[model samples]
Target: MLDALIQQSVCLTQHYTGSPVCNPSRAALLTGRYSHRTGSLDTLEWWGLERLALREEWLLPLGGLAVPGDLDHEAAKEDKEREARSDVHEPSRPSRFVSFAPLRDFVFQPAALDHYAATALFLACVRRLRPDFAPTADDARHIARICRLLEGMPLGIELAAPWAGKLPLGEIADELAAGLGLLATTLRDVPPRHRSMRAAFDRSWALLSVPERDILRQLSVFRGGFTREAAEAVAGATMADLSNLTDRSRLRVEPSGRYAVHELIRQYCGERLGAEHEAEAGETAEQVHDRHAAHYAGFLRVLEPQINWRASINSEVGPETGNLDAAWRWVIEQGRYELVQAMVMGLYHIAVAEGRYQTTLRLFDAAVQRLRAQRGRGEGGAGDAPTDLLLALLLFCQGHMCIDLGLLRRAEACTEESLAVLDGIAPGRLREEQTLYTKGLVALLRSWQGEFAEALRLRGELLSWLRTTEVSVWPHVPQVGTLFVQANECASLGFLTWHLGQYDVAQGWLRESLAIREQLGEERWRAYGLRTLAGVLRTIGELEDAERLTRKGLALSEAHQDRIGIGWSHSALAATLMSAGRPGEAQSHFVESLAVAQDSGHHALLILSLNGLGALALRRGNLDEAGQLYEESRASFERLGIAGTLRYAEAVIGLGEVALARGDWSRARARFREALAARACRAWEKMDAVAGMAQVFAGEGDTSQAAELLALVAHHPFTAHATRERVEALLAELEAELPAEVFAVATARGRARELDEAVECLAA
Candidate 1:
């Protein structure tokens, strides 16, 4: 009878509402096959209807629904068959399938309304419900939050839109935190299940098989999303179960191959999981939580070795950050110290690499305090290698993160405590290696605090000791007898030598360090080496190579999202650009570096960017802005307790240049003298200072003295290219204003003076 009716009719249309099993039956009738075979196993129209195997002869267009690509191909094949049966071949019409879904768009796109078409649907519903409503800025913000909280479900937005007339937008948003109870409608024309979100969820829940329901409940343990492996391990879910849930619109599979439950659905399922239920597997919420924690803990432990060696493994960890965070919190709450120890180092490295400084710091700080409290209770004594080693490692990781964040005092305290903890361990290879690494970190702290000479001495001693020692440390790579600790010391010495203006020595050490790091295949540390080497190249007037190396380092850093590397690379690139006489480009990079440094709380990088910007401002004749920037850089350096460093001296020279630009001869001279007096001042910085003094002398009408000092700076091989260019230009101007014979005599005298003699003469 149904076939006779379909054969007799011109066209047939079927519509159903609020029936849990309607779509599957409709799909079965259309395809003449089992609904499961057609992949149509549920009644949710948006996700399930697309699974139907509708024939090509049917001209009905399903708006806002995307037919799968294979279905389109099937339709084309049927069209060719129909054409072959006819007398004349006809051109195939375009596929009538559209890929737009108003509700699904809201579900899949980012939470921002302006970026998604959901904003239109939301506004249309709002205007229909409350015609006089004009949203203020605050109302718009609340509306966006509402859209996000609802996951852009059309019914939820429609049900909540009517409340716009009865309550403030903020109140409506706040009420949503209470859950699905807040979104219900009284419209009599609507189906009962559609009248409230909970009713709809309940109807869907009743249709799920017991296994499906159990997996759904267990999946609530995840925060963001989970991969198939993660789902299997944590929730005991199979592929078929996940597919069925997805067909029912209970979960969303992202393009990254991760499955996500909607927040509202997750909350509902979480509540169900928490309640009493006789699940066949007999797993409770606590048991599921335990499994979730254990799975991620093991996951992190597997990645710990790679993380310890600073490999480019952040891509593997980034997607699972939410799950790892949830697992960490659970383990800490349950006082699962072994689990905590298993995952802590990996988490710390991942957090630092991703620039989640404050959150990781807070988490680790709490963990440390808890461990200390446990030790105080005599739960773990000094001879307990595992517990003591974990604590010491935690303190060291904390100290390293503190260095990045510019919390110097805290970093010092943590490093010292880490050493103390290691002292309690029995003498062994692990203890010895750990002690050497901790001491290396202490050298780094000292370097940052402007104690470069001491840092150099300490780092050199470590390198010497590692070279003589025959202990086999577990290398990051396959190479036997390669000491990464020795390579690290070499890099430290390179940095210290650079700070002390030993460019030739710095380059040699940095090259050696880079060679070892390249052999290890550590991309993060290799990028560091590249940027540090680029700094030396830029200082020695190799602007092109400097720019090339810096850009390469920047790309590597961006690939891993390493904030410190990104910040430093930008600053280095900007300085190189500035030296190449590209102030405009340099300013943009400096600004970018400053913003990243500020966001990452990298005080040293921030100061470097500020000083670079100051140099650019001075070059552009913006004296007041230059002065302000220099003063800010100086103040920040002082605050970091490294006021005597070469960077601080650079800032002082910048101030003197600003003063010289303003023709404030006395002030410029005083600032230059102050910079020259810095113990950490490099030869190039001293040259810059003396050049400023020449300008001051020229401004004070001492042309002969100015000519001599300018010639001294110009002839100094240690003078930077940009500084030499500026000094030469000044010399030309001065020679034009002086007697020819007198200018020649003064320049000859200046060229004969040694660098130290020239600096002493300028200072006098």
Candidate 2:
């Protein structure tokens, strides 16, 4: 027994693997090699670079398996089909093998087996170290259970769990509780104490009072950390005695006014909520949940900004984590329009700054739902002026997101609706200059949509008004500060001019905006200015300049732990890197950008990052990877109803090329045609698609179609850099078709490698 072993032991001697992974940790654990030394920090993702599995264990002081797997690709179609078939007729519980396929494949288990022996040695040393305090039977039983667990494989322990009920009290309790609060599902035929963690947790649950039980049940509503105010709002109690209740540990007082319980206990509480509710008790159960959700939603709307103020006063000494994370989860998963909008607005605005133009769509959609619901019940409309302000602001926010995705028509509709509501409201609320700011935003978006004349005219109007008005002197203030209004107006003007081919003017405005942002310090709104400034500079072919600016923004975001901001900045930086001719770095940054965007639920930015990465991959001749990237980007765009993401078609063409390489001409043709169709959408998202289709057509021997397709791409009369890409692509395509005798033939990568062989040999 563990207790008995601890009572009598010699000096304890145990070794820990120095490797950081099965690939990295395995080497260290077994051979004392760190990740850097072994070059296996990310070996789990690479093919053949994985840590070697413990082909030979205990070769004495060594243990642990080397991992072997590449995880990026999906399971094979045949495997999935087989699983689907098995799932239908034969319903069997998934074993750890299949349930944790990718993770299990990557983990080294042999090294774990050695940990039990080490623990045993450590326990024996502890007792020997202090003979006066002999180990108890219970202690020995617990240590014994751990040793058994380490010997068994993942499923071996899982399957043996039920037998704990059958095992004797003192027999093999070592298999049960190995780590404090880090319980594993021990399934071996061990004794009751070693049998299962479920029993242990159940024992803990039976000890709480009704009030404490109620607190636990209510807290389950929150999935993340919750604040004290939020707890007060959701827990169905805010009595004066609550603090006393918390102090006694019956309730929990989270840091920064936020609280948390173990995830396992939360799940238990959820089960209790289900069991206690009656079948027809919709009001009894769901209503309470709805009220709870609403309260949390309102709390989120208020608390987020309040927390910022508290942190701003002293972020280093900011209030405890009381319940903020809980509020975040509440907004993230269950929020209605108000809460989600507040949450999005409250974020670091990295999404907007870094060019996560696509991710804000979910919040926009929620706002739409809110608007529709309000309208359906006629809560606020034309005559209801007070309510109309909020309604109009919500619509405006949605329109901004729509504009980000190139959904011009939908965006226009939203803008128009908000303006109509604006017209209906009294003259005293938001500023007149602010209205012009919106007008300018819509105008430039219209230009991007190809309504050049209308857009130009609107831009003129907005700029003229802004120049004429010294400052906002409105009797009533707009919700946003004057500084924000100025920054937004300037950024919008820069964007419009940049697209309209006025590089000098656009750059000037962007510079001013960026300068203003630099002075204002770090905040979500300022991040918007920083990102837009970088984007505008990039458009003017100042890629290096853009890179620095974007990275500056990214650094600020990192300092603030702004997930949305970091994602946005990294994405833009990737594009900047690509434009600066750093494909390898760009590719890596873009992938990380997309991952961050996906994790943050910023769909818009994820779409852009994916498409950008796909383009780089295609350029690098990784056509399979390119296609996957494009497909993923396209899905993100489509799912969020973010239209005008046809630029992803560039990768679709790459897919066609890959198909062509594999001798699948039919598939190649299909991909080419699809790319062409999407590219025809005419937004910037289609630029890559258009160029790609031309390349495909040239490759397929249709020079005339390729030339005609190429005609759509024109030289930017204003700037040499803008037209350089088109010229280069045409030359490369022509060369690809030439006979070796007439001219060298090669693909894009080949052309890059051998410049002489890559271009068409036009007559001198």
Candidate 3:
């Protein structure tokens, strides 16, 4: 019966009951002969009963039999030889071999379950563990989080699901966040290694060689994924070790060719790195961290020129943001001021473009504090221009960040301190350039404070000096010569002139700045110039051109992932849409700008977005919503101590329009008067206020006064096309109401009034 079964390719093997050991029985089953005849022995001695004779293979046909039995090392070697012989003779039936181990178990496969599948698996396990439990929406979310934290490992999910009976899902998630020990089961029916996440991880951990373990420990220092080069440099991982570890599923290779360890596994390795014995070379965790920091510092140094001069819009710093931030904190902790100084400017530009104002402010503030403490200790060398220069630059950069955050008072103090630090430095080309840069930041601060005239004067003087003076190239870097400063000054002049309602002059200055920026390949500055010029064009009623330029800027900003630039571009585009009478589209962009502003803590942009939303609401005839949004904008500007800004005036004018719609004549006049009195209210915005005042006068039956204000606004050269059209419509209405001769006289008198006279009439 056994021979017929073997001949039919259904061979079975088992330990013989009479034998004291299983090896002899296993050898007989493999060779279909007596153990002694096959050179297999039952004696427990060196090389006994472990191997079958290499020449014997009579149990079953190699290609057609399913032989189910354990094959030790020597027995497996003999089987392979016999199988090869059989393959050569048969010429058609090829033998195959497949091996399985706990390390390559199905539960540990590389492919993770998707979200829905993971959730269903978790819930199913939970139901099996506690049949009466029902999951809530919050429970589902927490389960999803737990699955993500565990990398969707099946045994991990099964081990964690039992805890749902003892703790809330959120608490279970919190416990998992604290450590991986929460993923353990007390169920005795399960296998020992399968019952706990740690045991399973230990099975894999024990398989790694000493060098592989050391490399993994070092790799724990990385926060996000790392490139092969970074892994080799920081962790001392050779290609063979990385490949071996990856094959064992110890590290995962991302689609982008970066490598990452599971977060739970990373935590485990990090703990071992912190507490384990020193490696063969006596390298400590601190030493590994130092290497990590040094590598990234050098990395940033290599990319610094590109970040500063060429690649501000789309720099290589994005992928390494996590690593760079970690490296920055480490250097700051170690008081490695020189390394910090080397990477500060590049990091500053990155923070500005990405709208990480608050985070970068804290980092730079810490750096400044550390430097000040070092100075107090007298640790700095004598005539330390580099140290002082770093301090000055940090202060100037911090001031710019503060301006973005609407902390104008702090910005002013920072600028003052930066200038004072520059004064202490010995007069040289470096000091001269730094001083000029700091003054430009101060001018920007003044403009934000609604002191446009002062900003304009400072920028004009800077531009003249930069253009006329012969700025020799620095010994180290010659790329950032006087031309860069001249371009910055010209951009500043354009911004100030725009705020002052000189649209044509603003356009000319912005175009010149853009030409220089293009020549220098400053894509970021070019995008900014395009957006500003678009605003000018929009105000002049060139809607098609304005939209085109605005979209181009938007595309550039989106491509660079520049959050601030994107928000500003959206706001600019929305304003153009509002002028073009597309309220629905305008509202959507305004909402997008508001969201970005809120997320980035950009206070100025937030206020601007609110004012824009208010305009859209007023256009849609939602008077109450418009009033509320305008009031919020006005209050925010007041709280920020920038109530004199043109934005605040615009908000006030919006409220006046709301009142005019409601026929609240007294409230309308009051709002218009407040707007006209704002110091930053330039010619076009003042004309808007005058138009509101004229409507109020007409509502109160003062026809002659209303006609005069409307005519005055229509005749102003700086009046925007949109405002002028509205004023003309109001004047025509007044002409229809009044007698012909009386209307003609009122119009002539109003057209003769100067801008200042018109503003005074509105204020009265």
- Model 1 scores a TM of 0.75
lDDT string for model 3 (1-764, tens) is: 34543443321322121221222211112212225555543221111111222335222112111111112332222222222120111111111111222211222232211223344556656777688766654565466556655544444556777789899987886677556788777767555665666776677677777888888888887765678899999998988888777765577675567776766677678767887826543878888888888988888777766553454424356556657776887888898878897778767877787676776787788888987787778777434688888888899999999888888889999999899878878888777777877998988887876789999999999889887876552213466567766777788788888778888899989999989877877666677888889988887899999999999988777766676888888899999999999988998888778777766667768877999999888888899999999999898877877786646688899999999999999999999999988877766788889889889989999999889878988987778889999889888888898999999999898899887866875687
Ranking by TM-score, best first? 3, 1, 2
Candidate 3 has a TM-score of 0.76
**Candidate 2 per-residue C-alpha lDDT over 1-764 given as tens digits, one digit per residue, 9 for 90 to 100:** 22332232211112232112222101011222225455432121100111222334212212212211112112221121112120111111111111223332222233222233333332432334344533354444333333333221121223232233445423333223212233334434333432334554465557656666666666665543455665676665565535644544334453345554433345556556556633423334444455565664554455444332232422321222123323433444453445554544433132343333343454345545655566678766554654555556656666766655556567788888778777766766353543664576577566545454466577556655655655662211334234444555577667666554566887788777666645544254455567767876776577777888788777666655554566677788888888888988887777666665554444557666877877687778777887787777656556655433334454465566566556675676676556545422322323334444555566677665455434444322332253346546675556566554333322322323321121111101
Better of 2 and 3 by TM-score: 3
Q: What's the lDDT for candidate 3?
A: 0.70
| Regions more than 4 Å wrong, model 1 | 1-150, 154-200, 277-280, 307-312, 470-482, 558-564, 584-588, 591-595, 622-646, 664-683, 702-718, 735-764
Q: State how far residue 217 of model 1 sits from its true place (Å).
A: 1.7
lDDT of 2 at 325: 29
TM-score of each: 0.75, 0.53, 0.76
